[model samples]
Target: MAASGHTGFKRIVKAAGYSWHGLCSTFRHESAFRQELAVSAVLVPLALWLGDDAASRALMIGSVFLVLIVELLNSAVEAAIDRFGGERHQLSARAKDMGSAAVLVSILNAAVIWLLLLI
Candidate 1:
């Protein structure tokens, strides 16, 4: 028989798989998500190109990952807003815009960190 933890392990894997699928779907439907993801996809490999040392590598990679994380959170907020009926409530607008702004700030943060660390 399978191990006792097999069921839980399978469930965790399925949930992670679903999350990745959702991220793909979200990237397709959400233009901003797609743009940020494209930026991040480029930045990761570029980091290894530019980052010749461990500290610079950490700075570059960490900053790029932060942008991705923020983008995912922004996508989550957008999905939440739409799921609630895509209403034009002021708070909803603020929430979504703030999420986007957070992403903007994250991009800026990456740039700043790169400048500080690499140049």
Candidate 2:
């Protein structure tokens, strides 16, 4: 019943392909995303070593993933806004700013989670 009319395993395969494309595009276009991904490369393994239990490990790793997710969303918003035009517009600026703020909040959330769990 999906809008694409492609159902069952075909839908899953198509969705996975689209997700991979988005990740590749984001990695190519966004330096911030690249930096965060680099940090995550270290953090995920550290989380595995430092975490005392399943819940703690999941929390640490999940928090790191959240940052990447938010950054992807922020990048998407900025891309859409940019596509409209280069001209300045108050609403467009606000949307971009809000997207940026969301990324910051996600990063802060991850930091707080790691700090709280570790110390």
Candidate 3:
């Protein structure tokens, strides 16, 4: 159940606002996010043009979007971990490293998808 009592369209509107805030914040503070976004900007259009059919276009575009989604989640994880404090902790380090690894994997996934599709 939702705690805010918002339902239907109101809930969707609120959620969109929150999502926009997150995107803006990530864009402002996360250099990696910005870099990925820049790459995605180019790749998405290239996917549309290079794709042979609808399915190909969708798959190519989807792969790029997946990277952005993963990056957002990774940024969120790092932000939550950082919120705790500046003090070094094993768990915090592990969490951050894992987030970084996830981003790397997503990039590799996109590259493989593009390569297989284009080749």
Over the stretch 1-119, how does candidate 2's per-residue lDDT look in tens digits?
99999999999999999999999999999999999999999999999999999999999999999999999999999999999999999999999999999999999999999999999
Q: Candidate 1: what lDDT? A: 0.86
Q: Please give the ranking of all candidate structures by lDDT, highest first, separated by commas.
A: 2, 3, 1
User: How well does each candidate superpose onto the true structure, as a TM-score?
Assistant: 0.84, 0.97, 0.97
For residues 1-119, write the lDDT of model 1, one tens digit per residue: 24444566787787798898988888788887787778878988988888889888888999988988898888888888889895589999999899989989999999999888776
Task: Give the Å shift of residue 38 in candidate 3.
Answer: 0.5
Clashing residue pairs for model 2: none
Candidate 3 structure quality by residue, lDDT tens digits, 43-108: 999999999999989999999999999999999999999998999999999999999999899999
Cα shift from native, residue 25, model 2 (Å): 0.4
- Candidate 3, residue 67: the lDDT equals 92
For model 2, what is the error of residue 80's alpha carbon versus the real structure, in angstroms, after optimal superposition? 0.6
TM-score of 3: 0.97
In TM-score terms, candidate 2 sits at 0.97
Candidate with more favorable, higher lDDT: 1 or 3: 3
Q: What is the C-alpha lDDT of each candidate?
A: 0.86, 0.98, 0.94
